[model samples]
Target: MLALAALLPLAGASFAQQKIEQQMSYEQFKAAGLDRLSPEQLANLNDWLDGKLKVETAKAAETAKQSGGDEDRRGLFLATSREPVDGTITGNFTGFGKGRSFTLDNGQVWQQIDDVSLTGVKDANPKVKITPSVIGSAWYLSIEGFNARAKVQRVK
Candidate 1:
């Protein structure tokens, strides 16, 4: 539900229920031949656009995640990108757990996606190094002086 909310271009917007009315300028609407459609025809057109938008949006999101990826790429990233990100964890790091998240000094936020936990430890601004897996899209976050590493996914 949150993802859908985030995906929508307009707040509280639902493509399925939306009509072409007021969605375009009067001149543009006539040019697009939407002015000639009957009420039922207009509804059918809206339904068609709704289905098309949902399918295309999902495809684009998937492509972006697989290439530029789950993290905010700032600009772009190649699938062969193997860059290691090293930065200090923002604020206090109270150890790791599944779904735990850490923001870095570089403005990237990553959350643990695995069941691995590193508990009973606390540190302010712990150093973090995240590197992509050699064989897959997975990224592992490693804290300085810690042997255990947690699988992480970029959220921002």
Candidate 2:
């Protein structure tokens, strides 16, 4: 149904009897070699037309969900390559020049994987932000007021 409608804008023709001839422009149909097609070949292609319609329907539904038509679809607007997670660290953050694990108050546990760390911040329950890598699930954590970002991964 949607594939037909998409072609409608290009063809400027109305549909009839599930036939592209009535829906597609004459030049476009000929360009696709439909004019040279045998009746059996055309019937075979038409038999698979419903698959195109299904793909188009799924695309439309995803577009609607991403556009906020469904309020319950949280994180739809965030990049799939990297997502943002923010919370308070469970303990006073000390510098970790090697590796360490951080447990957020929200129960998300992340472990540092890099060799960079910041010292001197002794505040309890400091705010933390974790941004995953732009290409994959590899994550980095940054404590509020700190300058260094450590490579991290979710442990829980």
Candidate 3:
């Protein structure tokens, strides 16, 4: 049900794109006092409606994309963290440092954005969690065994 709700607006957006003139019969258009509108006025109205539809479509796409069950595709945008994500490092897990990039098994790559580091620790395919900060949009990446975590930003 929740998935359907997320997709409903996207479906409506494509179907609701009919031009204003095409949405009504001639008599209905004239009855609405729209017949008196100049050609430019009607054009302006249609353009405005199109612009609004575009905005709504973009919003709907974002909402649908954010609906869970798609963890593999997330953290590809910069400076935005909607929720926590868990995945393992693709290969060897070395300690983290500023400017270091970690590629998850799901193919999402996160780059360290802070000066924090966890060195002298080595593990292969260590499980990790990337969590969003409470006060802001910042995110932190934590390895399974290490106590240190680094502030991270999605780069891919």
Best by lDDT: 3
Quote the lDDT for 108 in model 3.
83
The lDDT, on a scale of 0 to 1, for candidate 2 is: 0.59
lDDT of 2 by residue, 1-156 (tens): 333333421110112226556546789788766778788977766655534544544554565547555322212232222237778999878865556888789777777778886776677888988864322235678888877888876666
RMSD in Å for model 3: 17.3
Q: For residues 23-85, write the lDDT of model 3, one tens digit per residue.
A: 667886776677788999888876766666677656645665566424444445322224578
Greater lDDT among 2 and 3 belongs to 3
Model 3 alpha-carbon miss at residue 111, Å: 0.4
Number of the candidate with higher TM-score, 1 or 2: 1
Candidate 3 stretches greater than 4 Å from native: 1-73, 76-81
Clashing pairs in 1: none
- Model 3, residue 146: C-alpha shift (Å): 1.2
What's the TM-score of each model vs. the native? 0.51, 0.47, 0.52
- Please, what is the whole-model Cα lDDT of each candidate in the order they appear? 0.67, 0.59, 0.68
- In order of TM-score, best first, we have 3, 1, 2
Backbone clash total for model 2 is 0
Alpha-carbon deviation at 112 in model 2, angstroms: 0.7
| Residues 41-90, model 1: lDDT tens digits | 87886676566556654554566556655334521233223467889999
